[model samples]
Target: MNHTLTFNWMMGFVIAAMALGAGQAQAAYVIPMIGGAQLGPMDGTPMKHLDISFDGTNLSVHVDDMVPTPLLRPLESPDEFDPAEPWAVLTDKAYNYQYGWNPAGFITLPSNSAIWVQRLSQDSGLESYQRPPASPPYASIFASDGDIWQWSGSMTHNVYAVLNPTQSVYSASYRVYLGDSVTGVALDGYGSDDVTLLFNATVSAVPEPGTAMMLTLAGAAMLRRRRTA
Candidate 1:
């Protein structure tokens, strides 16, 4: 009886250890279409809009035409674009969305220049852009959960185009990565020619929790047979 009880205790520990270990291991989560976007009117008010994306690890925001100042730089190069400093925030224009957490600070645009925010983790490591949280100072917002976002481009020329602010046209060429650890990617967009908005981007992950549970149960049955032998 004593030996049998000890064996049962060992089995319980083995199960608990395995579960905890698996949880600690890296897992991915993807958000299909995070939330809706709000672009300001073309003529009357200075428009503000947000484009969000996730690569299982990071979140990015693109604030376009939030201010009406002439674009200091060209729109063709979407990767190197940066927001104007001193943070000119346009309250009249904004895009709201929920990604499992209440965001603290929002990416601000002065309506003059184009700016995009991206989050990357050290785990993503070096030039390899993957879906990871942004390091300090680079992020205007700190997300609580696993989130990733990217910026495509802005609509600066079409002054009268705001009544129907189309998604930026350049969003189609952009690529999002998760980390050096995984691969296999897909991308989507929001706007038209010369301008494109990246509505959202996501990378697939391991089987969901329900599927994992089923696998665990199956493994447990096999373990029981070995223990009996």
Candidate 2:
């Protein structure tokens, strides 16, 4: 091989290696959540706010944060991705009573967004088991927009939001409000807060070497074995 050709090939190898490293570092984010009803003072009317918080300084869920699950058939469907859980909600016996968010009322999902939720698992305590939920280790909770999902802070429920894959990037905005399990009314009068999740699938990070590279390495090993023999 000529010197120029060898140098060019080596540079390409370095670039590919860098790409692999960047992809690993930028792997889609999985946001863990800890939420509970934060009650207001007794001097005024009843007000309850479900505070959804994470460790990030700017709590905005950026476009790069979605969990990336590539499509099973990547060759056939290169643009399409698979449904994945980019975020999960869990509790730590924070509160005792059973509380929930009403999708029909206070909770608002992005319009025309294909997003659903499933309860992966939970510890014993629903008050315990608010309603007879489907057996878990991944029980589909609410697929439709109006489906109501309730949980108790007394128990540990791991809830995952699954986003269906499409050609374009997926983004969702959630307006969460604390709801009364009985009358089904918004407890917090000030419904000014909301959390938005934006996911971009640009970093195609999962690595698999090319067929040519594999073949070249095998050839080099065979040559070395022949010389030793």
Q: Write the per-residue lDDT of candidate 2 for residues 82-159, one digit (tens) a residue.
A: 235321222221221112222222223222221222232222222122222334434444443344444332222333
Clash count for candidate 1 is 26
Compared with the true structure, what per-residue lDDT tens digits does model 1 show for residues 1-229? Answer: 5755655555666678678877773433221111212222342333334344443334454445443322111111112212352111211112212212112244333223222322322111011111123232223331312233333232211111111222221121122332211121222232211222222212223567754665566568558988999
Return the clash pairs for model 2, or none: 63-198, 126-129
Give the Å error, residue 98, model 1. Answer: 26
In order, candidate lDDTs are 0.30, 0.32
Q: Each prediction's TM-score against the native?
A: 0.17, 0.27
List residue ranges in candidate 1 displaced over 4 A. Answer: 1-215
Predicted structure 1: lDDT:
0.30
The parts of candidate 2 lying over 4 Å away from their true place are 1-135, 154-164, 182-184, 188-192, 202-229
Q: Residue 188 lDDT in model 2?
A: 42
Estimate the lDDT of model 2.
0.32
- Model 2 vs truth, CA RMSD: 16.5
